[model samples]
Target: MQKPSIPKGTRDFGPAQVARRQHIFNVIRRTFESFGYAPLETPTLENLSVLTGKYGDEGDQLLFKVLNSGDFAKDVTAADLETGSKALLPKVAEKGLRYDLTVPFARYVAMNRGTLTFPFKRYQMQPVWRADRPQRGRYREFYQCDADVVGTDSLLCEAEIVLMMAQVLNGLGLDDFTIKINHRAILDDIHQAVGGVVGQEGSLYVAIDKLDKIGRDGVTQELLARGFSKSAIDRLFELLSVKGTYLEKIHALSEHIRLSIGTDYTGYTDLREVYDILQASGFKQFDRLEFDPTLARGLSYYTGCIFEVKINNVQMGSVSGGGRYDNLTGSFGLPGVSGVGFSFGVDRLYDCLEALDLFTSTAETPTRCLLTHFDAASGRAALPLLAELRAAGIPSELYPDASKLQKQFKYADAKGIPLVIIMGPEEAAAGVVKIKIMQTGVERVLPVGEVVAALTVE
Candidate 1:
């Protein structure tokens, strides 16, 4: 028989792992809600039409398409098969697993535009699939915790996103991180100044976005391979190499863009305003905010400011990222609606937490107290006590099989259950029960009715 196995780039979380993951989710969810973002969810599978062309060429190539139900190839001709997967994909697959929550959210906004309020704010925590090669800190299937606000062009929204990012990361016990900020328009200006091809701006953005991963030489090689002029690549790096504080770098870029384009640099100004807003609001973590000239989030829809976050001293990729999209809804026939958002990489964050040994001791199992018995009669006698404990909102469980005291204690210890209740025949006759604190090994004899109150108080 073939060995059973899960797909590569995916994971099966056991109970303890699930509990730890849930802890991460809970923090993100609570933070998103506290910022006045309502919870929203979209379907796992979205129609190909809705998914295609939204995330640019590279992102589109990473999409995981789902084939049509039976006879997916029944309508395809021999010529279609020979044309390659690209030509045949549409013929066989009409839908695909969502690449990310943001696009599906845009579709949702468009479909419900008439009924919903403007500037709809929502948070979504869901799994998305991709077809890319998976590696460390990168998965084919993973969860993204996102919060977005559509239908507004407020820089305050951008500032709030920065604040929320800091809050969530700090809440999760990660304080040393940087929230890199940039502008797509500024990237465009750099492209134009560097004599980048008019219609090939995406190439520049995609190449520059990998600056952190591949280093300067690598990005330059990619830019040259993509047909960028050597002088152009040098000029692009000249602007990207500017170093200083956030405001200082912003000023330098403004002067460069203004001198090169002979026009006011709105992107730089907007970026400055975001920083100023955060400063004015007394954001204490200004040290964590940075103005990155080369941070072009490769996603095509981002038309305004962009953000990416990296944790310090950890060997991992970005744990969170997102940006402002001016008119993502325009593709869905709802034009002129703007939005800004960010997403936390839950799986990566979990890995970082585990590596750093930051996860606190959380319950591996929900059962707080296990009722032990020596025989079937003793077990039956413990039933009433179990019900009472549960009724009092204490997580209590009964040892189903009559077992030795040592065996029961071992089971409770293995599960991290803290308390064990013993109700043997002798205790039953005495109208009392013994409660053992598993961690302390201290036993207390209490009346049957006092068990619930004692557990509750403890």
Candidate 2:
């Protein structure tokens, strides 16, 4: 028989792995909830129309489309198939695994616009699927923990997002990551100043977004290949190379844009206002907050601020990122509703935590104590105690068979159960039980009624 196996870019998490992941999720969920965002959930399958066009062209290509259910290609003409997969895709696939949470959330808002409250704040923790090749810290399937606020254009939402990002990272014992911030308007002004073609802005962003992966020389070559003039590329680097503090960089970029394009620097003012808000709120993590002029989040719908996070000293891609979308809802016929949010790449974060040795010891199994018995009578006598232990809110389990003592002890040790109750024939006859501390091998003989309290204290 062929060996059973899971697909590449997917995983089956064991108990320990699940426990560790749950720890990360609990921290993020608590942080999101503390910020007054309620939980929300969306279906795994969304209409292809809803998933596509929100992300950029490259992102659309990464969508995992679901083939239509029966006779999917029955209506297809040979000419349609001959035209290629691109032209024939719509005829066969109508739904796709969601690429991200933001778009579906926008769709939900558009559909329920009449009943939903404005500025709907929600947090969603769910899995998303992409069709990209998988590598270390990059998976075809992963979880994105996202929190978004819609129906407002206020910069306060941006500031709060930064704060929440910091809180979530720090709460997860990640103190050395940088939160990079940029604005789409800033990128647009830079594009215009660099004499970029109007309709080819996506090409510029796609190139610039790879600055970290490919250095300046590589970006210049790419720009040239993409029809950007050398002088434009030179001007682009000059603007991006502005140095000094966040305020200093903002001022310098603002002045350069105002001089080059002869227009007001609204993006600069927005950045300055966000900075002032953080400063007023006594945000002390400025060192961790960076004003990255070259940070262009490649998502198409982002119209205002964009954010990305990277942990220092880790050889991995971004662990979290998101941005402000001014009119994502417009595509769904709910025009002018604005929203901002960020997503934590749970898989990458897990890899980071493992690399940093940040995960504390968590119980692999919820079973706190296992009841071991030598004979059928003792096993029968332990039933009431098992019920009592459970009634006392302690997780307890009983070995099903009249297993050997060593076998039962090994089972408890392997499962990381801290306590094991030995209700042997003698112990049961004496109306007492011996609780073994699995770690230290110390055993205590206690009355049947006191077992719960003893285990509870331990």
Candidate 3:
């Protein structure tokens, strides 16, 4: 017999855990709805073509490929054997588990472009799978609470997303976080400043994005391993240190850029435009917003401003991340339309809550009151009162078995049940009841209406 074990990087959430997770999802979903976003859901499995080549090379490798249902081995070809066609393997194995919400969302918009409204607002709460290593605050199977606005290039989308993120986290009772903002164009300007390569965007950004995880020294080591020059590295370092008001970074870059590239290109000036717009929109109060130049989300599709949110004093991975994609849907022949969105890593967030002890009190008592059934007849007698308590908006559970009174009381006590309404033979015959305070274990005989009025959380 095979030992019962799940694949690595996956998880199984028990009942209480599901409740807490659902609570979090409800907060997010409700907040998204309040912001005029409609809910959207995609299938768990999508055509491999739709998912492939969308999340950059690293992401493509992390997709969980599905095998063809019938006799895939026989479909092998001689030319396929020569080149080792991982890309073409999907033709044999035609479907894949979705890698992320954003890509599938792009596919959806493209397929439904005729029907979708411009600046189509959508909120999707679903489980996304990644075939990656499982570690602290990361998982193979977890939920990405994503809200996106597609078919618009307005940075107003950025501000609204920032506001949405602030609202969601604030509603979750987490006020301590920093939303680090950066622009791909600004990074592009810096990249152009030193040894610009046409297709090096993904490789460059992925390395820079690791700066937080690996530190400056680690980033330099990784870039060197990726073949960056000394002069290029120095210039990129100067580019990264750009901070303060957006104008300051642009000005500083303007001055030092020529040192490496021999011409100070005025590319990052547009970012200052973005900053001015945000500043005018009163964006400063938007949840500890900070200018971080190192935010390079590994997705290739992001074509503009990018942001990441991190909790202060918490040593976890990014709790949320995303940015703009100017032409993602264009890949499917829908040209020039743009979209921007962000994803909240719910699994990492639950860990953050646990690490900070924020959820210490979230393991709510299952029932506020337990309807104690004294015996077979009394159990039968107690059902109406149980129905009445529940009808009165009380969360009450009936102990189905007519167990020993001690055992029933112990069940109520073990569940942290604050109150237990007992219908014993004498009480049932007299049309009275015994309401015991499980916390204090004190019993009081009371009328039925009195029991309902008493259990209200005063």
Candidate 4:
């Protein structure tokens, strides 16, 4: 048989890795809960129809469709198969893995519209799949920790999301990061100023969104290929390259809008108001929140304020991103509900923490102590002690088989259990337990009654 292997862009997290990942999840979950957001979950699989057009053309191509059950091709015509699979996909596939949680969440809300309360706030932590080339910091399968609020149009929801982002990062011990904020309406204003056609701003922003990924020259070349004049391209770049403080950028964009579009733009006003809310709420007390006109966020669904978070001094991509979508639920037959939220890319954030050496020793290795015995009688006698340790909330496990003492010690050392409790025949007879510190190789004998006290010390 061929050797076993996992698919590319997938990972098998070991025990230690799982513990570290749990710590990250715990941080995000606690922050979400503290903000009064309730937990939610959606299935990994959704109908192909529900996912196809939500993301743009490029995003639609990355969906991993599930084949129809047995005899999938039974209905396909000879001409359909001859033409190519793309044309025949509808007949053969009806379901696909969800590419992101936001769309699925929208679908969930729409389906339960009458049963659920208005202004629903929910947080979902789940894996999503994408059929794309995988590389460093990019995965085909990964989890997204998302918290969104629907049924409200207040900008306070947007401001609260920014503050929530700051809270979660600070809780994770990540103080060095930037939260880039922008608005789709402002992008439209820039596009209009640069002579973009009324109905084509979506495609224009999609290309302009790649400015960070591909530099100015690359974006200009793309705009040119899409039939934009060099003059328009230059003006677009000038608007994007405008620099200053958060308010200064807003002012610059406002002046450019007045000169080019000859109209007052609400997007600039909205951006300034969001920034002011953050300042007044003291979000700056913990993290850096800035207005970045170049941050387009690439998603076509975002219709209001957008967010993208990146770690400072690291080469990794944005560890978190999301924005407002005014009509996402309309496609599912629930119209007029507005929602704003953000998602934490848990895997990327994990990598950031690991690269920065921020994971604490106890967080990485969760099991604090191990209890083992030398013989069958000793093992039976040690059971009560193990029970006591567990009841005291100490993470302790007993060696299943009364194995050799050296072998047991080796297992404890390999697993990074800091303390090992040994109850041999002599110790059992004397009603005492010997404790060994794996790191220092130091040993101490304690009476049975004193074992709990020694292990319980913080």
TM-score head-to-head 1 vs 4, winner = 1
The order by descending lDDT is 2, 1, 4, 3
lDDT of 2 by residue, 1-458 (tens): 99999878999999999999999999999999999999999999999989888888899999999999999998899999789988899999999999999999999999999988888999999999998899999899999999999999999989988999999899999999999999998999999999988897999999999999899999999999989999999999999999988888888888899899866677878888889898897888999998999999888999999999999968999999999998899999999899999999999999999999999876679899899988888889999999999999999999999989999999999988989999988898899999899999999899999988877886
Model 4 ranges off by over 4 Å: 285-287, 362-365
- After superposition on all CA atoms, what RMSD does each candidate show versus the true structure? 1.2, 1.3, 2.8, 1.7
User: What is the overall TM-score of model 2 with all chains considered together?
Assistant: 0.97
Give the Cα-based TM-score of candidate 4 against the true structure: 0.96
Better of 3 and 4 by lDDT: 4
Clashes of 3: 0
Task: Write out the backbone clash pairs for model 3.
Answer: none
Give the poorly placed runs of model 1, Cα more than 4 Å off: none
Model 2 regions lying over 4 Å from their true place: none
| Model 1: residue 30 alpha-carbon error in angstroms | 0.8
Cα deviation in Å at residue 322, candidate 1? 0.6
Models 1 onward score TM values of 0.98, 0.97, 0.90, 0.96
The global Cα lDDT (0 to 1) of model 4 is: 0.88
Could you arrange the candidates by TM-score from highest to lowest?
1, 2, 4, 3
